[model samples]
Target: ASSRDGYSWTEKQGLKSGVPCIGTIQPPTNLDRASTEVFDVIVVGAGYCGLTAARDLTTSGILVADNPGSRLGLRTLLIEARDRIGGRSWSSDIDGYSFELGGTWIFWGQANVWREILRYQMQDELVSSYDFSKGLNKYILVNTERAQHFTHEEEDEMMESGLRKLVNVDGEYGKRVIPFPHTAAFTAEALRYDKMSVADRLSEIKDSLTPNELSGVEAFVLLCSGGTLETTSFFEFLHWWALSDYSYQGCIDYLVKYKFRGGQSSFAIRFFREALASGNLSYAFNSPVAEIDDTKDFVTVSTRDGKQYRAKRVISAIPLQVMNNVVFNPPLPSGKRTAASIGHVNQCVKVHAEVRNKDLRSYTGIARPENGLFYAFGDGTTPAGNTHIVAFGGQNGHFDPEDNIGTTARKLQGLVPMDIERLVFHNWSKDEFAKGAWFFSQPGLLSNHLGDMRARHGKVIFGSSDWALGWRSFIDGAIEEGTRAALTARTDLAPSQLKGKL
Candidate 1:
């Protein structure tokens, strides 16, 4: 691949942060004129969460009680920092292939995203990374010592045994620790588990597991947390286990098996289109919020460009780690401030590469966190018949994609030998808007700060994927929080409008 093909010798020289796409549509309403008017709702950060909230509010015919029996749509404004729609879930086109630069996979187990797939009639667009019936063609586990290949049966047996032992703290395979995975309900027993980090738990079971089994557990932890085991909460991992029906195979399927035919951008554009069709939704792209002031009367959101917008209610869909950048009028709740300051423990990198190796179409690679490459898998084949692979590595690791393209390719080859051609990626950790890849709660986040993170401050609602109850940090969670925040705003404002208080 050449520079003309969107591949450069260095990322700083040629890698585009986010590609141009149809999702960056201009809302029909003119923002210059709308600035003088107060909207019924202003949704900040036009990610999936904000998009869903704005869509619901603008579409629902909430009655203007002052005019009695007359239904009027709520005026909503969606402000985005980037020119595109999907927040961390973006799809970029490099040459003739589609590379999901951010969040990629989806499954039926993720209820909210699944509903949107059905609603948008995209069920036929679903595709698997590989045929599950045939299983993985190759399984290689890389450690400092060597790279060992295992048969499908051998890998499954070791993975199941190691993972089961890791989470079976109470001898019930995480069920007793997290009986209710979707809820914030934490028993005293659960709190005890919450206090332990992944590293701590691993140490508790390290003696009982074999070396290969231990490495399997380590690879999975590094993949999910994206951070080292010392900081990731054990309870957070347990919650995923319980949600996946307490089976290693189920977790694998739920996490990385299925993806949309085109990309997540297609799914996100559907929400954007629906919101615009409502006739009440207006939007401003390239608007980064600087400050949020809740003045008891209404909320005034000030962008960095010195423009102010007013709204009766505001839903802030900013990512958890990026929240510290914007100043709040009456400072955010103490717990929320603490959580934001501490941040999620997911500082990782995801890189997509095209390799001239058709034989690796069904290969899966996992390496120790200390290695340059932590995990990788064959996604599919490109138009040129090259294998498309997505690889992830932890921050501060040996691999630095931005440093040099040739070095990055060579490092990837160390994990899985392939004739590398081109690579595409986005450094989410360095992104001002994202600050991190995905949310992986730290040790004290759940037990000490979850309720406050979900609570609202005055008229500002916390509707981000970071604190979603069900599938936090996933596309499904973004939709769940977005839908809930919209309904909450409607429920509260309806009565006030009837009483003429708004």
Candidate 2:
């Protein structure tokens, strides 16, 4: 079902000819079993959170051996449902060009987690875009004849206005509107937008916007949220706004400076290779975890294959929605269980196309009434001496890759000269490993479940971008959660100061 190294099919002549490649042999059946008997930590999921957790825990002065030492060397296990290492972050070669299929782009201002990527020396491979201040040309397709260009100042004003509204409501800036679940300033800020959809919010400002301005704003909402205002939560929009400094200007500035030069997948691959080299990490691929038993002192994890792994501590980095399917022996608390049942954002499908054109350098955001394809922009350089463009369609509706590829291309064709060669699309809905791109707080759901959903269950800790308070859907959030969870685990395992019995 997955394409490797591009192209639809490749010949496997070696198997038929009975010729063996060097160092190629049958994988051991006991591969899932660690070379050692037990591990200090068993991390389920090999995504950013899981990998970073394993790496940090292992390298710390902790001694991980038959007998625990002064600083426990962390023995970690990472399990992935897919054949590849990256959970949602993935990249592959298509038409001789590197294309990111999942999450891409990192903002420079994302201090804590993103700084790790730079400290680890990954920035060179991940390129930043052209200057955002120069005001990259933007075009909007308001039906056929309505296509118009937006000036940089116009775009900046629109973004600033949106952010200003998000943070300020009823003459209050950065105030908490909701107080039931938790009393916090951001919560109030989040509550102001909670009742309205992105579309509904925009309608209030329609009178102030020109025809082109309205269309551009509509497109920006759809593209950024990955769904129409009708489907996207106002709180979620505010959350993103907060993550990007409460301004569209800040968001674009971060986007232009923060991105994977070689693509996010490169970081994933490097992490995987590094984990393997550590010789302390073992993994089970294509194996979906079915159950987790935390009744005993040690946590036991059972995969669909019926194989079990027992460890002192467990980390569930899987998306909240998927976690509901895995049975927990003691049964998760009502709140945590309810949070999982609430599920993630709607299904998302991303399309990448390589066209015969180089002049198309700027990113394009289009908002169409009939079809709001979230966001589409020129992504990378193609092998065919052209530009690679990508589109993100969120849960609002579905678009057939084959049927709509022509239409999407034509829309872009009007803006820039290009001959579409081939198209690549990934339906995350159809993907068993990931049911959706990212998690979203539905109306009335965050108030009811955000806290309990993040609470730890016994020795098991849950960490993912979805559970993060800030930058919920970004890699920075994932790393922040990973670091936080690791610290929690480390603290819990520390020896009690008052060991003697009274």
Candidate 3:
């Protein structure tokens, strides 16, 4: 049951497993034949990264002829540990309301994901989760002992002012450091301040900010750093600042404003469907890769059941923390191993709750990182007209949504003052395949290990949102890395096969 369902719900004392929109459905594949034949490229992890790579590699144009050797195009095999496709970016329907259990939200600024959205004609599916620019909604800020009401404008001002002080490391607001965030070409500038943590920077700017301003900044840090400010990198925050156009509003709008109306699962499934349509693609679900051995010419991927699949090139798209589970023959570099051991500092848990309050329907709740519930907002209303609120917190925080359901509900109510009905979430931190939620680089990570994290180990090409150049830790970043990995594999393939717009 755990293998089949990606989400769990807690209506009572313990969590009861529930199905995601796409995880339970298995796609048809010829894994037996796939194992017998050597593939041109093997993609591990059927998340957005692997799926995008498969799609691009398979559709790169093929030459057909009577002779088998005359045929062109990369034969791609995608292997997934779970029965589902999307790794952490999947959606579930709870009480007739769509809940994005993992990576959700996108914007026009995210080039790779936005391009795919346009290509798939899913632009119409995009919807704003909430528009803070309008100043129409109620915002609850709980930085002090009690919750206080503030208009969206007031909240924005405090946050904007506080962030200005926090991210302006070079007085140009990180521009001097990270002029091109996607390129990550700021090593020298970043190294100078690589040792500083988000907590350190916040402490430096706290005296300059008002109590409310400091509260807002702390909440932003908690949310952005995934509740680990003391270890989360200031350079990582600077990268985000540059990626978000160097504004607090841009960070909010780009990171959390927009999402697909049909849910991210539907969007992710489209890539799978398109990849499957290409005759060059095959896949195996429920096949967890135990080891990857890169010999002189080819790489052999061995699943837990001892089945081996050989490929000229392999794209390892799994998360950094999860990578420690898979053994490499020659072994990864010491830097990469150490980086994976440290991992990203995001042990934050995301929880979605349905509430029966009309007045609090579209409100945004912000709290101090230590307060347990760091950030939350009314995502949407259910068919029953109940408001659906999505909240995030640290794993060791006061709100234990996965356990102690009564206490979690009461704690949430203390923040938003709503009558809770149901709660749904996935514990990515505890999941074997994930081990953590979205990646937020730790101090000295970008300066010391970014290259090692993204570098290829012989024929095994590494691609993951965790190490993407631009939108790291986003669906867009997955596509960026996936597309790059596919193109890299294609370069090694026969030049005749690469005729399409890969």
Q: TM-score winner between 2 and 3, please give it.
A: 3
The candidate scoring highest on lDDT is 1
TM-score of each: 0.93, 0.83, 0.92
Model 2 / residue 423 / CA error / Å: 2.0
Per-residue CA lDDT of model 3 for 422-448, tens digit only, reads 787887777889988889877888788
Clashes of 3: 0
lDDT of 2 by residue, 248-294 (tens): 77667654345565666667666556656676666676667899899
- Itemize residue pairs with steric clashes in candidate 3: none
TM-score of 1: 0.93
**Model 3 error, position 441 (Å):** 1.4
Q: Clash pairs of candidate 1? A: none
Ordered by TM-score, highest first, the candidates read 1, 3, 2
lDDT of 2: 0.62
**Model 1 weakest 10-residue run by lDDT:** 1-10
Query: Could you give the candidate ranking by lDDT, starting with the highest?
Result: 1, 3, 2
